[model samples]
Target chain A: MVAINKEIVTLDPHLIGVDWGSTCLRVFLIGSYGEVLATRTSAQGSSSMNGSAWAYEQSLEQLAGDWLQEYPDIKVLACGMVGSKHGWLEVPYVACPSDVNAIAARVMSVKGVDQRRFDIVPGMAYRPANGVPDVMRGEETQIAGVLSLRPEASQRSCIILPGTHSKWVQIEQGKVTAFATHMTGELFAILRQHSVLGRLMPSQQNELDPIAFLRGVEDARQGMYLGFAHQLFAVRTLGLMEMMPPSSLADYLSGLLIGHEIQAGLGWRLAAGLEQAPLILVGDPSLCAHYAQALSHCGVLNASILSNTAPVGLWAIERATAGVHATKLAHKVNV
Target chain B: MVAINKEIVTLDPHLIGVDWGSTCLRVFLIGSYGEVLATRTSAQGSSSMNGSAWAYEQSLEQLAGDWLQEYPDIKVLACGMVGSKHGWLEVPYVACPSDVNAIAARVMSVKGVDQRRFDIVPGMAYRPANGVPDVMRGEETQIAGVLSLRPEASQRSCIILPGTHSKWVQIEQGKVTAFATHMTGELFAILRQHSVLGRLMPSQQNELDPIAFLRGVEDARQGMYLGFAHQLFAVRTLGLMEMMPPSSLADYLSGLLIGHEIQAGLGWRLAAGLEQAPLILVGDPSLCAHYAQALSHCGVLNASILSNTAPVGLWAIERATAGVHATKLAHKVNV
Candidate 1:
């Protein structure tokens, strides 16, 4: 077995990568080459854990205690909301345009129950030239994983992490130059669950009706001049008028929000002069599919999808940090 | 006093105007001159009453049974969601571009427990040339009231009724020609109460922080290219970075939504070539103030505010219907 360092004794089952988000915790026991050897997921997200140190420790122990027991010195790399102000430990954000090395260097360390250190990757913050600052906690890791999987994407790409807060990130030469956060998913959830539009729709999510969804997307694309809030009213009107059934209304609403998001995202890319950059979607397969459909509808036909890249990203960061430390140690030994 | 009908009615306690909506029931005792004599409001909105005919009858009786008893033949005119599909009696929507005459002609009658007939005014539906159909429940009556109060508005005007579903109506020659619904208020409410952005703001809405609000408006004004959902994330980032406090985030969010709404409404107005039409704000005074401020900021200088015009609107509809009925009777007699 290849030695990682004095601390991480083996390369196989090389690292423990944790993607701790607001509502879910995903753990990956990764091999040296960034392959996920085994995986575990739980609903014990950071938010549910209430940022309690003991709870976080207990959760980690419960989820991957055997890995810690079997490989006593293997390093752990965690990302996402687990690094936020209300996370296990408030790992500060690394500002953009940041590379894997910049992110790796800024990771904060916390001790597990056995006193072994775990590295929590810092999130990235992007300040627009004149608007309010934008921030992403877990998406940076996903983007990193995309870069690791498709190295060319690192040179020039626009990676979209489509979820609650969808991020359209700009990458240049292996660094995230800038990114914007779109609240499309969150808006859809709230609108479908709480607004007047929700009343006309079935309480539960219906199956995605492709025709209805595309209708919504087309409406959004053509009705951009109508304003978003106005366009949203169609959700209710369509249901009331029986133009769209209750089952399809939700899909329509989803399409409308996603459509608007793609329109805006494309505009953002065009404005950044990254129009020629390769476009990539990184998220849940189904969500990516919806985004892919929307992007294709928006005349973007070349966008590709990558699923859950957190493990590889975590691996990349861990290795980068280890190399930086190894170089520092060698320099000291020579001196 | 003047005899009004064969059933024997005086003109002083002219009509009972009810503004029964989704969340609240507002009743106005109006005089012959369309002036409100007395008003009563209750939390028994149509939704809460659950389309229970008994509950709606009881609500109206409890609030204005005295007036009904005093003038046994007095006419009653009700508007808003009270006539919705889920209301006391489902009145079909009067298609646009409809005036008071068309709306009054379609008024449906319902019998009270005492058997006195009451009129429920139909809402309006506007199907755009190439988009989903738009519907408004009670706002049609309010438009009628605006026309009565300011006759010149009938020639050409834009009346903005700002609320849960803010309606930007176009009036041409005393008729609601076309209108657009912007869900600004509802959107703000849901986003402030449910979205991730809501978590950064104070649970209890803080006092309007004007500076923070204006800042958000300006950002939305200049950052239209960034897409609405993307710009929404600033509500969270601005709070996280300590650039803006939690208390101000809600206001900032409000400003952003309102600003976007105004931008869209203005664009709709411009597209319809009604730029020269007088702009009027008709809704809650406080909400109108906000809209007025937003409108002024967007370079529309003279938008005026008209508060709760439902009473006059009901009066106008009742008079129009009475005139129509009288005409029908006289025509029958002549024949």
Candidate 2:
């Protein structure tokens, strides 16, 4: 993942950065030079909104209107949870290689039974060509957008898109080949606020202590082999001195969660052969760095931090399209 | 556990039953045998009073005087949480083989440390020859008393003591040979009230579906080969229709937790060995029945219930020595 030149954020006229999150909806209006003319935020988050039969129109009017009303017509591209089944609009799920065209073709902008005009971005879906089925929502759009920027990153890279439900997508040759998600954040919250350990926890956001967090990782590896539940008892009954601070226990829970995911997602390789390929971790620098640090111990030496490219990659869908294709993807113009 | 023909609510010349639970202290004065002469309960729970100190004397004099005023010289055998470290009196933990003699030997009574004349019962202590260390509190006394009633239960009996912390102990030769405890009840409360599943669950307490509860047992078995943290995700995400009712989730979680203990406790057995031994389950009959039913599926064929034997067991200590040994177990006793 290479750093973008200074002009990238400023000069992409067709660029549009959209953040479709679990709890918030946000869209930024960018100019031909990638300059933000305006931004829109809404209370309805991804999981809460409907298929947009009525809502899609209202949110789109507010979001796309900020720029559309002025330019009265500059074409735009959208990404993120806006494509979810419950978003402002329901974008059909697309299987990956998942270029702008595949997703763009699935966009729906028809006035619904309620008479609303708004376009929906589509997400990526993966079915077992061989194993269990899985799906990805807004992240694949960003991954494609990310790869579009760095063509070299199109092959075999791990993209960590973090949030309450963070995803780690495996991209190969310009498409989101496969991926898995971890509910790390949610688990951390539950453990800290709800478990017996709650008594020992201090009320404050805690930092991940590299020293302590690593112990958790070690314990998970040791403990996963010995039943994590009983081992949890060991933490308390061993006495306060031996028990990791409730905060650290939180981290241990997180590590154990991710470790189990790695076990499931990686399977056989986790058994002493995870070196099949290097791992690329995205999201916030600190967390990705922590995951990378732990993965390193498991023998994955190359861990790169992918840019928080969700916004950049999301916005790039416009840049990746042919001018004719862009116009064609939109509602037919009437003059 | 044996059942007495005498009633618990009537009055006679005998002493009443005293229930010293972790949270409350209750004294019941019954007839010479087991008839309730008169009953009075108080808030001076086991932990609230200082070591068989002044508070016990003041409270007991008033409480006992309520009914025992007639007999005036009746003896009282206290049981339950009062024998804990925080109870009116701290009784030393008796080692296994345990019986009334050991319990009677450890009884301590002080007159308010200056005035109260009450002998606090002692629980049992167990340190495995090889295994993680743990301690038993009130359950030991209950088990000992129950053992006294069913002497043959000594050889190959399984005791199920349920509460905030539930323990399953295997007894052989009239001794609590080995045991494992799971905080099933506490975990149930925490998960139902605080975790994300809290959303999926209905607020009202409803009966747990045996199917769901059984699924929890099945899911908990994942502990043997997988970390529980991940296994829980399956329940949350897939929303196993079986484990859906939040109320039953407790029962299910209990099944899982208890099942884990049973497996761990009996892991050394060869195939098809669970049914080979007799099992004695002590607790609320209903809950004990559920546990026994679950164990039966795994081939545990012989499980019997122990009636309300906790108090009787404590009293057996007094009956065995006729209160003579009470003063002897203390650092020094004056009566």
Report the poorest 10 consecutive residues by lDDT, candidate 2 chain B: B326-335
Cα lDDT tens digits for candidate 2, A60-123: 5666554555544455456666665556666667874566666656655544443423445667
lDDT tens readout by residue for model 1, B104-180: 99999998777778799999999877778999999999998888777778899999999989999998887898999
DockQ of each: 0.77, 0.19
Candidate 2 per-residue lDDT over residues B90-153, each given as its tens digit: 6767766565676677776644433325666676655555444445666776776566556677
Model 1: residues with Cα > 4 Å off, grouped in runs? A1-11, A324-335, B1-11, B324-335
lDDT of 2 at B245: 43
- Residue-pair clashes per candidate, as listed? 1, 26
Q: After superposition, how far is residue A306 of candidate 2 from its true place, in Å?
A: 3.8
Please give, for residues A220-335, the per-residue lDDT of candidate 1 as tens digits: 88887778999999999989999888999989998899998888889889988888889999888899998899889888999988777887788778878886321111111100
RMSD of 1: 6.5
